[model samples]
Target: MGRAIVATAALSALLAVCGCTVQGTDADGKHHLPVRIELPGAKASPSATASTPGTPSAAPAANVLWSRGDSGSGVRELQARLRQADWLFDGPTGTYDDLTEQAVAGFQGKRGLPKTGETDKVTWQRLVKMTHEPGKWDLYLMGGQPAGAPDPRCLTGRVLCIDKTTRTLRWMIDGRTVSTMSVRFGAQYTPTRDGVFHVYWKARNWVSTLYNSPMPYAMFFSGGQAVHYSYDFSARGYAGGSHGCVNVRDEAAIASLFAQVRTGDKVVVHR
Candidate 1:
């Protein structure tokens, strides 16, 4: 009886071991115990989430800074900025000539700024904030005695008026009325003298012997008064401004006028 009990006990132990199945499969179609593995983020390891397709990446914003000075590059940059702001002047050539000075003064005056010809940090900042808006100004002509009819000397040409109120300059050209930038004039003592004259001559890189002023693309309209590039205080477009001269603040514009105008071209200046 004891021998039979021992054999039965051994057989029961073998059956229990055989009935315990493992999770893995083998080449012989037999199961085996699997190797233990701890999942990521299961208190054993850390992992990041994978990125998906069609996800947009954020872009950086534009960063703009203001600058100033008379360096060639800086001047060019300022000119470009002014042009972009619809200041329709000339390209910066690094020469702080009369035209550039005039344009700068005009720009400052239009913005209610102090009419200093020099550009400063505030000017740079203001220029950056400027926008391209169409400008208009009211002008008056003051030449020749007033009669019921147009004076014979009053040749068929347009008079340009620079309006201080609106900061714009308007004129008639080629039978078409047009407007441009606004500028300052001289004070009562040296107001832009009224006259009826003709473009008698043109001088590129012109130098004024009377005032020792250098005029770029000077177009003679009166005796000593001609339309030329200047940066004098007259850019304010006030009264009694010039020393018998019509000052323009844009060199490119003067160049344009030089290209189109000829001797005997009539110019009428009014109040």
Candidate 2:
């Protein structure tokens, strides 16, 4: 009995030196020691799973962000956040229109996020960290204008550098944009021709021979391609396009451009 006790004590001491817990004896009186073997410099396993199926993750943080065709105060707030980052121009229109999508895309691209125009919770969280809270006017943007950087070619002398990507017409003289106007282009089926050309002719109060619509302050560049004020565009915003022309929405700005531009000035319609 003494020897048996010594043996059991020795076994218990050995188990203790092995860094095992004293789970006490089992039903049979056999030691039920549970050992958690760890390497010399290993981190401990978590007591429980950090995330479960329905549990929110650190990544994406939030769900149900914003996307196109979603119009509401939430979208306005999203736009306000983007505007604070300078990725969005103009005030909030309370609508997730093309402009807002483009701004979202720009912001995502800058931040190395997926360049989807939609605002997921991850996108929103990143933006929130970068920008401050929005004010009433910043969220609404009662009145503002959207503009873009001129094409590099527009920085040269006497170039009407029109960028289809930005939908902007820059009146560049001596490598400077003296005037800039928001413009739209033909639809997908009638994409404006991208090339360098000269304004071969000008016709004030010109009527479109093909469509029979009035084209005020028309400056013809390519074959039947003109830069002119579009009444339909003015009434419809970007909802309409010309047959194959650059449609300027601001009539007053185009009329002034018509006077300043010479018949033979350069017209660079680029992507």
Candidate 3:
């Protein structure tokens, strides 16, 4: 009995090393083991027939819709919806870059989905249910928006009618909108004052004495506040802000406005 036990122990160890499983008892009460002989250069099955103890289960295959490195109107709308849910900021840049990936992961994690950073069908459905359809302006928040109806104050005169809500500036000549362009404003702390003001001064090529920044085609309305061309705004889009100045990104538009707008032109900044 002792010898048989020792032989079974040794056989079990050998089979384990050779990648075989030992099991069952013979009719004579001896151990029976099955050994699999792997032929040289033979192709074995890729997956195991049965799972081992303590082994991790395989992750489910993702049903991907949109993922990183993707770009288009779809990604733009995704970003816009993410913004609506307050999960993203800085863009509807239309490219699923690092920020968009992180935002998607965060959203997935919050909703108890796998945090894979991919916009899978399940994730997309969940997000769609939570967010409303993004409008044209929402998708083009950083860029220009189609001009809404002119504000009551913007009507009737030569006016640089600035609407804070639309983030647009309309150059109106005798109540007719001659030109319109996208605009940006200051930060929350140093906000662009919302009231009726005027172009008290016009500087074609001026520099800020306080901040020492160039202010081209500057039309100063209130104290230190002007409607001017902003290189930063043009470069960074809506990601940056001005120092209490209304920033115009389009250089040619502002240059044209500078030519048309005389000193003491009406500048109405309203929400």
Clashes of 2: 2
**Residue 116: error of model 1 in Å?**
26
Model 3 misplaced stretches (Cα beyond 4 Å): 1-75, 79-138
Candidate 1 local Cα displacement, residue 203, angstroms: 0.8
lDDT of 3 by residue, 53-134 (tens): 7875454344787899999899999999998888997678788999999999999999999999999889998999999998
Overall local distance difference test of candidate 3: 0.86
Assess every candidate by TM-score.
Answer: 0.37, 0.49, 0.55
lDDT of 1 by residue, 1-271 (tens): 9999999778656654554322556899787754234443444222222223675324422222222334454564565556556563444344455666677777889989877766777787888677433221111111111122223333346544333333233444544444353334445666655556667888988787977878777777667767766665233233225565666655565566567666776666554
Between prediction 1 and prediction 2, the one with superior TM-score is: 2
Question: Model-by-model lDDT, in order?
Answer: 0.53, 0.79, 0.86
lDDT, residue 168, model 2? 76
| RMSD, every candidate, angstroms | 19.6, 15.3, 14.8
Highest-TM-score candidate: 3
TM-score of 1: 0.37
CA lDDT, candidate 3, residue 68: 95
Least accurate 10 contiguous residues by lDDT in model 3: 42-51
The window of 10 residues in a row where model 2 has the poorest summed lDDT is: 137-146
